[model samples]
Target chain A: MTVTDEYLSNNADYAAEFSGPLPLPPSRNVAVLACMDARLDVYRILGLKDGEAHVIRNAGGVVTDDEIRSLAISQRLLGTKEIILIHHTDCGMLTFSDDDFKRGIQDEIGIKPTWSAEAFPDLEEDVRQSLRRIENNPFVTKTESLRGFVFDVATGKLNEVTAS
Target chain B: MTVTDEYLSNNADYAAEFSGPLPLPPSRNVAVLACMDARLDVYRILGLKDGEAHVIRNAGGVVTDDEIRSLAISQRLLGTKEIILIHHTDCGMLTFSDDDFKRGIQDEIGIKPTWSAEAFPDLEEDVRQSLRRIENNPFVTKTESLRGFVFDVATGKLNEVTAS
Candidate 1:
């Protein structure tokens, strides 16, 4: 089969039926950074499909050094141009200090924690801080765009937090 | 405080400090979609950060119609150029077929299963299939980059699952 066939058709099961590698369109796709809060269910909330966007997750959807590295790869190697920072309200991680989180982890898994115990106590502030953090970060994709939002845990909603 | 002053030295603790109705950046950041498998921590593995990418999560990282809408927003409203697809080995979601999964949900959670329960039986094959699935998705950013990888559950390594 030709290369175009793989990514162009939806009739076959990718797992059990299809046999060819997909032909990538000669274009750049978008990337998303969001929280791991189970309630968010970003896939359903955003109504996404397979292979559309690269979704990055972390506590509170907060940006960090590691997230930067992947974003760079997405930009430098993969050609991503945009980023969306989605942090939600009433995130479980938000209720406790970073230390409290560490203690919880210790209690559950019995291990030493590496991150700060005092994480973002306020989801909105974390969103705002994360927006600037990425804008100022040298590692951020300079050519790409950046934005931040606070998703309401109660309602399927989005409230803008920061823009750069 | 002046915008520059607030952004520069403090890197303020936003969780508690940010007020509502905040300003947003002008740039249209990119979007990314990945799996919700606990073993595949997108931020830790991909090295991403806030304001860099928008992330979508699901059981198998399968492409559904909804994912397309999110990608559309990332492209029309936000600016994105690429997408990274990551799937990991030994995912629990892979352990059961759709029937078993739904039945388990009904039995355990006492709620009707709301989503599809199709199971991906193998890791290598799953990633390969995912590549084809994403390549052919119609709602994807036509001009965006798409790449896929099979992340090792045990070794903590990511190898390009789709050679092409």
Candidate 2:
């Protein structure tokens, strides 16, 4: 079966126990920005309930312009006041460089994307950089409460990165 | 106490029960791109185990250039071969125009971001557009297997959007 079919069947099983119309605003008023890593279960890792937090994931959990746009909506339109940036150890983002990836894509697809992969060699530095990007953005309220964290995929440990 | 403090305490409780080291590549070979809406519990809804799927989420589940970058990593570096884009009804993305949001950010932050919020007027059309994006991108292999669905926020139902 296509994964869609399987997911639909599973969703039917889930809807039997489904509870909603959950509120538009997150109960905790927090938005989490993290990677799309399969190993990092954000809900289980952060102890978030179904309707407690907005979890935004992209590669590396970098605060891109698009991510900033989302955070803006999460803060201004929705009621999320706090921002949490979570990157992880052994992340796929740390494995490649922007130049190599762009060249590889060019070789494969005949298209050189203008966008950078936003890869970084140092994990904690990347987390700190993302934290600063959010903290410095004037549109994002509650800068005083910004925090960055790095999760170890192997041991399931999270270490907070203090602002440099 | 700050939300971070609460999360840290909860995480300690969770890590005590943690199981790992799950494989880097997803077990189901699928990458799911969905919204960051707090209401949708992607794993529970799709019956996904911890390491079965890579879940990429953002404001409206719109596929951005960065999303393409992440998907490239998911397929090229990791082993994922299928992609599912799930956009839900009553998205905050439908609540504003790009021009108005840009104006608001400019007024508040004195910096007009050169980015689109990727907002949509209709949810299904947006899903169709996102599906087409995945289908059209040369960087994303296995386009023949792409699927788009709209999850009903109130009913807990997901209806597949056949490409137009």
Candidate 3:
């Protein structure tokens, strides 16, 4: 997998941006909602252009209320016409509960996780729930095509989830 | 600075999930919406717990259409009550425009950084823009006290942005 020269520190270097541009994405504009797990190389996996897609990542990528609202605006206000929800295998989010994270905060840092009640019991369930949740979400435009997939971090493959 | 036993890996043994009890956050429940920068070990720097706060990360950490919608719901529905917007001293978001990232996608795995946006052009303006973006966000419940801070990733010190 080709890594962008820009890492966390040098990402801001406009000069180092992708010099070899590819044909714009399928939609030309897309919105990606995925997990924050460092393992997932969103740009590389999606073959996306930097400015082409607005990437939104959080734990689990469960398509919560916030995600739905974002999807709604993405198609309505932003140029995006497609929604790609990526939930991958072996995500840190799937490993713990809110309490586990909270204790990490209390015992360690004085601060707390900003939002809570965000707990995903299983990985496959997260994918199933996210699909069902986004498909029915009113925030997303009814006509807008909402699709999801489970990414295999090991295989670097993307497969459509027909049921979830 | 103690790191969790959890290893950030692709083959991360998530097998324990079913057999293991869910991890819980500490007594303090705080959530953070920060940029996804490895340099910023927010939990470690802040001494946070894994589950204590709901950490939501994204590109630019810009609270646009979906972010606002999510923020509103996050406050109204989710257990979180506090929100922290942490912008680092040297950020890549300012250095590269949407075009820069879009173009750089094929060659890289992630959008890394090199030069600080500090001298590129609009330094404080970028930070101010981010601060105002979050402050003016309609989704973040005004009922919930919102705070913004710019942390010097180098020094590990924080300074609250009161202007916006």
lDDT of candidate 2 over A1-164, digit per residue (tens): 87667878998888777767787778888899999988878988988987888999987899887788788888878888788889988788888889998898899878888888898999999998998888777767644367889987777878899889
List runs of model 3 lying over 4 Å from the truth. Answer: A1-27, A103-114, B1-60, B63-164
Candidate 2 lDDT score relative to the true structure: 0.84
lDDT for position B104 in model 2: 84
Evaluated at residue B43, the lDDT of candidate 3 is 46
Which has the better lDDT: candidate 1, or candidate 2? 2
* Every model's DockQ: 0.03, 0.70, 0.06
Q: Candidate 3: deviation at residue B121, Å?
A: 18
Q: How well does candidate 3 score on lDDT at residue A124?
A: 71
Candidate 3 chain B weakest ten by summed lDDT: B1-10
Residue-wise C-alpha lDDT for candidate 1, range B1-164, written one tens digit per residue: 32223222222233233334321211224344666543344444443433345565554565544444344434433456566666666554465576764564456547544556436787667766666765665444343566666655545556666644
Candidate 2 chain A least-lDDT 10 residues: A136-145
Q: Which of candidates 1 and 3 reaches a greater TM-score?
A: 3
DockQ, structure candidate 2? 0.70
lDDT value, residue B45 of candidate 2: 75
The best-first sequence of candidates by DockQ reads 2, 3, 1
The collision pairs in model 2 are none
